[model samples]
Each structure stands twice: as structure tokens, then as C-alpha cells.
Target: MPESIGPRDEGDTEPVRLPDGNLEHLDATVRQLLDQSAEQARQLDNLASAPAGSPFAGFPPGPAMPAPAPAPRPILELEGEEFESEVDTLTDWVETFLMDTYGDEVSTAAPWCLQWQEHEDVLAWLHALWLAYHQHKEPDAGLAGMAVWHRDFLTHTMAAVRAPGGSLSACMTDPDRPAHRILPGPQRSARRTGASTPDTGEAPA
Candidate 1:
């Protein structure tokens, strides 16, 4: 009770005595903290000096990306004799297909018509139609393919070729004479029988 210790002031940083081992431990701890602080400062400096949009400013770079591939081309671009050969082949196949599929309907539906295989314009149109239609002619399409051929392809083609002033009509007068009328169908047969029977002639006994 002879002397009393007072509380330390806020600004007090006076050195305290310690054992030799304790002093060495304190020195090593201070050096480690200083080293950690220096490393943090170095990283901050690098970030501040880095250029705009640099991935290294905040994170490391990753792997590079690959380029895209090119698109495919179509198969209907033959030239010269090759084009003629292709058209001929396609026209033959289509004509056979139509005859085998809907010969009777075509024979009556559009009686006065061009031989589509011989007519370049008709062949071209039909060939394109066949190419487009065949793409969807898998086994699953079944009767739907034939239905579409008749309803969409055949209907449009017959109309275009048989209309009064259509491609077939134009072909009738072509200098090359590539097209001709198909006869002996139901409509023509009826007309012929009617014409042969005279109005004033008496009935046979």
C-alpha cells in the first residue's frame, strides 16, 4: 500500500522488459506481419497500374475459344451437259412416279397437256418440285407424300400448264415445238362421240 500503480495513458508506448526468448519471439512476429503487409501493397499497385479491360487486373486468364464452322451448299447446281443430264434423269423419274401413282386422274383431269418430260420449262418446275418433295418422303410420310404431290404439286403444275395462256399454251407455238396435246381421254372421247352423232339423223332400227 506504500505505492500504487495508475492506469496507462492512451499515448503511452513505453518499452517493457521481457525475457530474452520472449524478445526474439516478438521480433519474428513483427517481421512476418511486415512481410504480409508489403505483399498486399505490391498486389494493389499492380491492379492500379494495369490497363483497362485487362483480365489480370482482378483475375487470371482462361483458355482460348474456337472459331465457328461454315455452312453446307445445295445439290442442284449442275452445268452444261451435266445440267441437261440431271434434268433428263429427274424428269424421267418423276414421270414414272406420277404414272405409277396417279396416271388415271391425270389422264382425265388435264387432258390437253404437254409431255412434261419433253418440255424444258415443265421439266424444270417439276424437277424442283420433286427435289423439295422428296426431302420429306421418308418412310413415315406414307400416303401423306402422295396426297401432297396430288393436292399441292400436281394441282399447281396442272393449272400452270393448262391455263389458257400459261407455259403449256406458250409451248404449243414454240419454234422448237417441244410440247403437244395429249388426246383420247374422257373429255375428248365425249366430244368426238357428240360431234359424230348428227342432230337431224334418225335413230337406227
Candidate 2:
């Protein structure tokens, strides 16, 4: 302890009373704090410089605070490298957690695609589901968060993706032979033009 601020003898229980309005008392308190701080710094320096295996040696440092959680990812809006990076992360989550855990038996009824990422519709649905998974898995999502996800989100999506005649119905029905195909979208036909001879024959009829 510094002589400037250490406790006095047994009889000196109370500090010397200073008048409230006095600047001298304030100056004294400040000087006392500075002296104590300097003494502490010196002690710390000495302890740090002490020989190995001293009582204070190898004292554990304070625990570091955990980093703040990252911002929520924006979905379906990324481009180029950013898009690809997000897809990579999504692929890992889908393969590791989604497919390994909840994957149903693959058959003509419950179709599964090996090349699901190539299908735009399947990609969009999975990405959306992936985003939702992250959201609900966080501490802030409450106790029943995962339950809500499974019921409201996962069940319906899996059904839609794997149902008979769904998007992946034509793909990967058998494990031994893999197949991938993007079903063509609906198209309208061009109107037919009537020939002059056809118009004359119609008039004659």
C-alpha cells in the first residue's frame, strides 16, 4: 500500500472530515487517487518482471467477451462471388443438417434430385428455407422456435419438393442411375395465317 492512501492506526477509524465547500479537499482527494493508481501500476510492473514460478506468475488473464452476432444475410439479392459464397454455405447446411437428418426415402412418390441446385425453383425454395433456419435457430427465437420451423416451414416445403409429380419428380428416382432434367415451362403457339387459295375455297363452299 502507498503511504499516501493506506489505512491509518487502529484508533483512526474515520477519515479526516473536510468541509463540503472547500476546493482544497477536492484537490487532496484527486491527489490521493493519483498516488494510489501510480502505486498499483508500479506493483503490477514488478510482479510482471518477477522470476518464473513466483506466486503471481502465470496468473490467468480476464476472459475475453464473445464477438457480437453477425448481421442477417440478405437472400436472393447477392451476385457473382457473393452469390456463390452464400450458395456454398447453404449447400453445407442442406447436405449436413437437412439431408442427413430429415431426408425421406427417395422413390417415384418422394422424388429427390442430385442436381437440385441447378433447378432454379428448387434453388429458390431451399435458399428461402435456409434463411429461415438461421433465423429460428438463434437464441432470440425462444424455446419453441425450431418446433415452429418444422411445422410451419419444413414439413410443407419437404412435401412440396418431394411430392409425386413435384419439381424433382422426373429426377433421381433411382439411386443406382442418377438423372437431372429441367421441365419446360408452358408456351403459347403462334396463330395460323390463312392462304389466299384457302380463303377462295371457303368462299366457294
The estimated TM-scores of all candidates read 0.37, 0.58
Q: After superposition, how far is residue 59 of candidate 1 from its true place, in Å?
A: 34
Question: What lDDT score goes with residue 191 in model 1?
Answer: 51
Model-by-model lDDT, in order?
0.60, 0.79
lDDT of 1 by residue, 99-164 (tens): 466443333233334455555556666666666566547667775876776677777875665555
Off by over 4 Å in 2: 1-75, 188-205
User: What is the per-residue lDDT of model 2 for residues 1-205, given as tens digits with 9 covering 90 to 100?
Assistant: 6566555676566567767768787899999999999878877777687787777644434579999987655546678998888889988988999989999878888888888887777877888888788779898999988998999889988888888887898898877768898888765332233323443554221
- Backbone clash pairs for candidate 2 read none
Off by over 4 Å in 1: 1-77, 99-120, 140-143, 170-205
Backbone clash numbers for all candidates listed: 0, 0
